[model samples]
Target: MTGYSALNMQQKQAIAQYLQSLPSLVELDRDDGVGLKRALGNYWGQFLPEEIDSV
Candidate 1:
């Protein structure tokens, strides 16, 4: 909660949205781990850019 406590509301919401975008733990276990990791990275990358733009 150290860094998390420092985040603004929009930043927090963006992170929440990113978490929502993630595959469930069960899904991740069932799928190709490497591929799912890559997709999660890409998803966060896309989310971050838009959040930055808004700032």
Candidate 2:
């Protein structure tokens, strides 16, 4: 929890109440039968400033 805790102690504290329900949604993805790891957060500047498909 070091990575998350460092960024948002207050936010982390708030979501702590729901810790008991932290089951993996990926594990329950019945449609695909093979769940994929979805990356969280916005990467506004990680790659190119303009996307070819942005048009």
Candidate 3:
């Protein structure tokens, strides 16, 4: 398996938290698809709370 799959739950959670802490597109001036995709991929399986994601 690739190194990504080897990440432990805690590591995943940390990544998620880091992602969640990032500024939104408007705030960061990163409204492009590539920027958004990069942000999402950086956190992979991590999901934000519904309220936040819905915004």
Work out the TM-score per prediction. Answer: 0.39, 0.23, 0.46
Better of 1 and 3 by lDDT: 3
Give candidate 3 regions above 4 Å deviation: 24-27, 32-55
> Across residues 1-55, which tens digit of lDDT does each residue of candidate 3 receive?
7886888777766776665565552455546546656767765535543355564
Using TM-score as the measure, name the better of candidate 1 and candidate 3: 3
Q: Where does candidate 2 have its weakest 10-residue lDDT segment?
A: 35-44
Name the lDDT value of residue 33 in candidate 1. 60
Colliding pairs, model 2: none
lDDT of each: 0.59, 0.34, 0.61
Q: Whose lDDT is greatest here?
A: 3
Residue 11 lDDT, candidate 1, scale 0-100: 85
Model 3 C-alpha RMSD to native:
5.5
Q: Which 10-residue span in candidate 3 carries the lowest summed lDDT?
A: 44-53
lDDT for model 3 comes to: 0.61
Model 2 segments more than 4 A misplaced: 20-55
True-structure Cα RMSD, model 2: 12.1
TM-score-sorted candidate list, best first: 3, 1, 2
Which residue pairs in candidate 1 have backbone atoms (N, alpha carbon, C) closer than 3 angstroms, thus clashing? none
Report the lDDT tens digits of candidate 1 across residue range 1-55: 6855788778866775666566663455545666656654665344454444563
